[model samples]
Target: MIQVKKETLYAGMLKGLLTTFDLAKIIIPVSIVVTILGKSGALEFLADFAAPLMRVFGLSGKAALALFSGYFINLYAAIGVILTLSLTLKELMIIGVMLMLSHSLFMELAISKKAGCSLFYVLLVRLIPSLLVGILGGWLF
Candidate 1:
């Protein structure tokens, strides 16, 4: 026997739509803002400030903005920043790998704390692996 109610289907569709809308709310604004910052040279300033450090990861200084966005805000924001820039495949790969390892630090940290995990340990566990992987990916690619 199988049962699929119309109301349940409608509710599921609505929930999916709402989730998409929520993601769009964050992604669209962030894409626009990063685009504006790129055009206005603000990202260049940030890149310069982070250049020396970013070089270690085989990324340009400008990529610092994407990393910052990914770490603090969310991966979608980082994607927006990345899309605005003209990066090589290798650069993109390094950033992609790094972001996969660690993103949404503030939100995840709060969640971890609420779940009774040590904040410092949570941060260290995520960040160290991200950095190491970034370094290795940079070297390999």
Candidate 2:
């Protein structure tokens, strides 16, 4: 029979709670900031600036906000932006796959480097596949 200690369970719960708090710290502030940017039309300006590049992925200029949020901040912020937009199913799927492939670049890249991976190689590996998949998805759907 397997036994679990009460102290061990409590410690695990504490760790989980702390992790959630850390994530919320990042996510909540980012969500609020992005909301402000959207309301103030700054997000639209950014989207317009990125439109040409975004079109290659079959996504609208507005999707640039989600992609930038996902890349710099995290996936939760990206989802917040995505929720506010009216996107087609195909666009959502393409963005979903691309974000899955390359989100959290700075944090993950640092973690990869700490794990002894070459930073440039890790970056290329993460970004190249994301771009390729985005292009393919754009072409197909």
Candidate 3:
């Protein structure tokens, strides 16, 4: 029993380390790129253009980068942006809900299609709820 428990503990530790390493691989590069864009004023330009839409969700224009990364890339990429930004707890909560509902769009859409789900249906299911949450969260908080 002792040997089995020790083996399990070691296995769990290895898995945790591997997971952390994988997340770091994605988050580090994304954070660096976002930081560069922010420094160069490119993010501000994009933010201004996206401000209207992002505002509806009670997020700053820069937060749109996080949403875009979450939707198009993955949660880790969004986290990278979120970590670099100084967002309020409310903003973080709203983004968290939205991303939870609809992250990794392209990859998930393909997987859903392969699994016999319609592209439109999958998109509708994810995006509609996310939009509603964003709108409601924006208004309430």
Evaluation by lDDT, superior candidate among 1 and 3: 3
Local distance difference test values of all predictions, in order: 0.89, 0.86, 0.93
Clashes of each: 0, 0, 0
lDDT of 3 by residue, 1-141 (tens): 435588898999999999999999999999899889989999889999999999999988888998999999999999999999778898899999999999999999999999999999999999999989999999999
Global Cα lDDT for candidate 1: 0.89
Worst 10 residues of 1 by lDDT: 76-85
* Candidate 1 wrong stretches, greater than 4 Å: 1-8
TM-score to native of every candidate shown? 0.87, 0.83, 0.89
Order the candidate numbers by TM-score, best to worst.
3, 1, 2
Q: Worst ten-residue run, lDDT, model 2?
A: 78-87
Cand. 2 TM to true fold: 0.83
Leading candidate by TM-score: 3
For each candidate in turn, give its C-alpha RMSD to the true structure in angstroms. 2.1, 2.3, 2.3
Q: Which TM-score value belongs to model 1?
A: 0.87
Which residue pairs collide in model 2, if any?
none
